[model samples]
Target: MAEKLLEVRDLVTAFDTEQGRLRAVDGVTFEVEEGKTLGIVGESGCGKSVTALSIMQLLPRPMGHIDGGSILFKARDLVVASADVMHDVRGDEIGMIFQEPMTALNPVQRIGRQVSEVFLLHKEMDKTEAWASSIDVLEKVGIPSPEIRMSEYPHQLSGGMRQRVMIGMALACKPDLLIADEPTTALDVTVQAQILKLIADLQKEMGMSVILITHDLGVIAETCDEVVVMYAGRVVERAPVLELFGNPLHAYTRGLLQSIPRLDRERKTRLPTIEGNVPSLEEMPEGCRFSTRAPEAHDEAAIRERPPFEEAAPGHWVEACRFCYAG
Candidate 1:
């Protein structure tokens, strides 16, 4: 068994707005083992990205804060880490690949300078060495003609090449844990496959753990070892990839799996979907957050109180009314 690289316990993160303090991640708990990939799968507004940002302590300051709970990275509490400590940890220990490379990359800066900053700031490398290392990493991430590309700006590169540059920058310092927030989003199918494959190859080569946040079950299936299903800022199910796919116990999980467009299956008049919508944080439903959309949420227990995360089989966990999805 691999060592646990990161452990988040009952994490509650919230954003304070004029309306109220809205909890974006409520009581979410999970762990990532060293050299393994843990996928956080959920739809938009499900707090998947927020959870990653909280771990990095990059929440937008006073507006966003960790209300309660602990984020233990390698057994060190990150929630309370000072600014200097967090500054050191961000790129050197826990690198992040943000969703959009165009926005994430500096438009005015040259690609080589941006990539070299990681080595210059954390690795104690001088200008010449850092610049050399930048080109080397670009090549390592499969960028064509790395030396020539180094002098170009973000707009000069195609979407895929820019993404590769982002990956290169993230991995430049060789962090222990990599958090990729929708890394393959907005890319073409072929490019998506290439980016996913690159990440998998890099993780294996570096022997680092990964926290992959995405809504695409297909991507999760291809790269993840374990998956955490989130709905309304809460974890609804957690299990190994195969078990979750083969024997999905939560109604929400089943809905997600069913909604996948399968080429082998007969086309339906209308695609299956979970009716209604994810509740807003302020007006979240009582009992189970998903009970509003659950087909079998008629029982009193499901409506009266929140359900506990119970282990259904080995590592498979389901948190819903006992009778929900029971049939």
Candidate 2:
């Protein structure tokens, strides 16, 4: 088994808004082992991105806070660390490719200079050396004319190229773990595949663990070793990729699997979709968050109290009312 690279225990992250205190990541727990990829999947507003930010200790504060829990990166607690300490760990030890590359990159700075900053700041490299190394890394990520691209600003590069630059920046220091929050969101289908392939190749080469956060199950099936299904703010199910695909136990997981478009289908109509928007953080259903849309959902009784997530198989987990089993 690969050594555990990152472990998040009972992570409870919340946001304080004018409305009230909303728990975005309520008691979420998972682990990522070295050289393995753990994909976190859920619809929008399901706390996937917030969880990623919490792990990085990059939550926008005053508004957001880690109320309870620990983010253990190689056994070190990042949740409770000081700002200065976290700065040292952010890029050097734990790298992250934000969901949107355009916003993540500085508009005013040249793309090459932005990528080189990681080496210059953390790796103790001089500007000249950092610039050279940045171009090399960019080329490694499949960017064309890395030396020329380095001097160009963010607005100058295409979306795909900008994303490649983002990947280059994130992987520059060869961090042990990489948190990719919807890394291919803005790219077209062909570009998306290329980016995903690049990431897969890089992960294999570096033996680094990756947490890929996305709403697309197809991407998860292709790139992930294990999968964690989240609904509302909690993890609804988790299992190995093949097991999750072959024998999904949770109703929510089943819905997600069914929602994937299959080319082999007899009728090529519109794809199946999970009904209802994901519940708001302030008004998450009490029991199973997925119960609202699950076809087998029994009653609001399940929503009266939180259901225990039980292991239905070796690594498969699900939370639902016992009443749903009565039939």
Candidate 3:
């Protein structure tokens, strides 16, 4: 087997609210190999972002907690690492691009200073060297007027440009792993394509592994080498990207695939939508969480117990319901 860059095992993250302790990331397990791209896909509130945050150990303390599981980077246990140690590991070995570039970037600071911070903090480089490297990285990420743009604050750049800056910062240290959470959200189709292409190209050029979190199956198809499908905080299916697109076993995966708008589909036909909203963490169903939204799961008999993640075919795993199995 290829050397694993990062391995997440039975990760369970939770948030304490007045209502109860809500499990946001429940038992998500996967690995990203060196120089490979892994996509985490799910609708909103499915714990995709939380899973990434948990791996980074960036959860807000008062409300959030890493309740269980192991996050191993290079065989070093990150779950028990100190904040200072985590700080050292974050930008130096593991870089992350958050979902919202506007919110993730500091509005008050110039882009250069923000991007250079990684170099200064992790590489222990002088301010001048860090700044120069910042411009170089920005230029490499295809940002125009790199020198001038570096001096501009976050508000001065377009959505795509800001995203490029975010990617630049994440790649600045040449980290082994890059965790991108919905990197292309809200961008036009053209810009989205550009950003995804940039990531794919960079991953190859830099020899970096990536975990891309998004709801769009199209994005996964375009970029990821492997795919993990999540529902109600659990991994319902996982496989090679081509295997997933070619033959998805889980009903939820099928629903997601059908929801993607395709030019090949008959014109003027409305796209299929998975019925029911993702269940709130506080009100997760008794058995398999996805049973509630599953097209053939309207009856109670369809949801007796949570299905085990079983291999339906070589390298393709999914949680299967007996009723759906028969169908």
Candidate 4:
């Protein structure tokens, strides 16, 4: 069996709003295996990013917190870990690439300072050593003219270059796991492909596990070994990539797959879509959250009580509601 690097069990992340305490990640459970990629797929407001932030302990202070659950990294529970422990773990043991590089990067800092900070903080390297290491990382991530780019600010580089810098920072310490939360968002198709390929190449070179959170199934199909399908703060289904794509059991998963535009289809044919927006936290359903939007008729009991997430096949788990479970 593969070694488990990270195990998140019953993760419940919440925010205290005027409306009251609202759970954004409700009972989310998944694991990342050593040197493998796990993709978390869901629409906006489905708690994908919140789950990532919860793991990193980077949630908005005062309002957001992990209300319940255990995030275990290398057998260590992060939920109860001290601030100092988490600080050590953030970039040294686990690194993260945020969705947007423009917003994530320090606007005023030069590229060298930002990238070298990772080594300075985690590796305890001096200014000269850290600067040299940062340039090496920038070069490794395919940043052209790294020596010159190091002196430039975030606004000086192109979108793809900025993203490459972000990748360099994340991988500076060669962490055991890398959490990329839509690392290619807002980039052109060509740049998106390049960024994904760069990440795959680096993962292979570094031998690190990755938790890739994105709504793009295509990216998941290309890069992920296992897949977790989330809807309304809960994981609706999970399976190996081939298993999930070939034999999707949950209604929500099926809907998402069907919505992907097919090249084999007739020209101008309308692409299918999952109808209805994700329900607001205040209006979230008490039971199987996807049941409200599920097209087929379902048992009323599903609405009254949450259905058990059960394995329908080897390595394939689904929210086992009568109507929701296709198998």
Best by lDDT: 4
Stretches off by above 4 angstroms in model 3 are 298-304
**Winning model by TM-score:** 4
The digit string of per-residue lDDT tens for model 2 on 162-262 reads 88888888899999989999999888999999999999999999988999999899999999999999888898778889998997777777778888878
Clashing residue pairs, backbone N/CA/C < 3 A, model 2: none
The TM-score that candidate 3 achieves is: 0.96
Query: Per-residue CA lDDT of candidate 3, range 95-125, in tens?
Result: 8999878888999999988999989988878
Residues 224-285, candidate 4, lDDT per residue (tens digit)?
A: 99999999999999999999999999889999999998888885868888888898999987
Candidate 3: the clashing residue pairs are none
Q: Which pairs clash inside model 4? A: none
lDDT of each: 0.90, 0.86, 0.88, 0.92
Question: Between candidates 2 and 4, which one is better according to TM-score?
Answer: 4
At residue 130, candidate 2 shows an lDDT of 93
TM-score ranking from best candidate downward: 4, 1, 3, 2
Off by over 4 Å in 4: none
Task: Identify the runs in model 1 with alpha carbons over 4 angstroms from their true place.
Answer: 297-301, 323-327
Q: What is the lDDT of candidate 4?
A: 0.92
Ranking by lDDT: 4, 1, 3, 2
**Model 2 RMSD in angstroms:** 1.6
**Ten contiguous residues with the weakest lDDT in model 2:** 318-327
